[model samples]
Target chain A: MDQSRRFTQVPGKYFLIMKIKLELFGASRDLSNKDFLELNLKNKSSIKDLREKIINYVDQKFKGNENLRKIIETSAFCSEDNNIISENYQIDKDQKIGIIPPIGGG
Target chain B: MLHTKIVDLSKEKIKPENAEEFIASSKFGASIVFYGTVRENNENKKVTGITYDSHDDLVIKSFKEIYNEADQKLNIKEKSVYIEHVKGYVGLGEISIIIAVACPHRSEAYDLSRYIIEEIKKRSPIWKKEHYENKESEWLKGNPIQAN
Candidate 1:
């Protein structure tokens, strides 16, 4: 709803761990019932890392819903700016990820 | 320069006929309108309704790209195309999308109409969700095409 929530800061042992916010859309929103999530990932984390966290978040929240897991795996990742990003892409500060699940428009 | 009647889901209903009316001209002899309707069932399951969402900005951009692509591929001179998609809830037998293409010849109109719809499905950022009577919902099985 807010499009994205502000990042949360976590105090880490060596340094303050910054949060990487993820925006949800379509199936990702329905399955997780969350519009945004703040991951304790450091800057420069791979897009694949973000993917894993989304998958894991679905797992934890939805339990044994394999259908939802598949959706996340097959979804296309995009930056907050709406540019498509590959799984190998890196996460950067101020960059918010959006999970666009398989589309079904007629 | 492109034409679209795209409107968010609301009390206002989508009229596929609008595509034809908007593109109608004395010079063009043929106009084809394609309407995509919401069906009552999917995979033998009774689907009560459907909904759609998209990255708003990219959806508009995608439409522009699609319009340009169609114009180039068709070598469209006097011909023109129109697209309209309704987001949010849509009931059975309602139009989800409307595509219209006008050309001097009927054959070209048909092909352009088909091509526009096909490309929109494959290339647009719009996504659909199906709701079954049994309280189950699935995001339909197609990836949102990413434009490079």
Candidate 2:
């Protein structure tokens, strides 16, 4: 049940045009009301860049949902299983990252 | 060198007894079993049921990662440890998660079991939606929602 939807953003410095899918779950999904969103960004975008872009992206689309904005603010990024991401972590155009939303697991 | 006996995300009821049986052995004198269940009340509101969700593939991956780390970090790497969580609807008083650990000595087993559950909480990708008896549901985790 996966289909790609491209989100258009202004071209950044690294204009290599990479397509990365966002996999969301937990509180993130509950608040955002989305299962997934695709990011088509500069080729070698950092995790920090993606985070800001998500904020800007969501702000544009979900301006009314403050909770989801807060969730995006607190969410963590992972390229694969349990990869604790740092702000400096770079995402290749081919990489897919999962967003772990704000709520803690019990 | 604690070998992981089980790391699962099952949609069935979590049976603590099964975990007890898995850790039952003469070689291990100490064992610890912990169960997390759906209680009937939260903050004085009736919690009818809970629906647990997971990033299925990531949940197992995270569990294996935690299991492997526990096996090495605690020096009980070769001991027996099992962890499981339910993936679907679980009613009140029903078990949702279980952890069983055993070692030749009592202390290590207790310590390891404690470590596993805490890690699972901090690292696992599991999420639970609280369903109130009045039909209010929430996924925000911890904050109780008022039923209309």
- Report lDDT (CA) for all predictions: 0.75, 0.69
Model 1 steric clash pairs: A103-B142
lDDT of 2 by residue, A1-106 (tens): 1233333345553245667788877766653456777777776788788888888877787773787677677777777644657778877756678877643455
> What range of 10 consecutive residues in model 1 chain A has the weakest lDDT sum?
A1-10
Going through the candidates in order, their DockQ values are: 0.48, 0.28
List where candidate 2 sits over 4 angstroms from the true fold: A1-14, A31-34, B1-13, B56-58, B61-78, B141-148
Worst 10 residues of 2 chain B by lDDT: B139-148
For each of the candidates, the C-alpha root-mean-square deviation to the true structure, in angstroms, is 4.1, 6.2
Candidate 1's fnat?
0.56
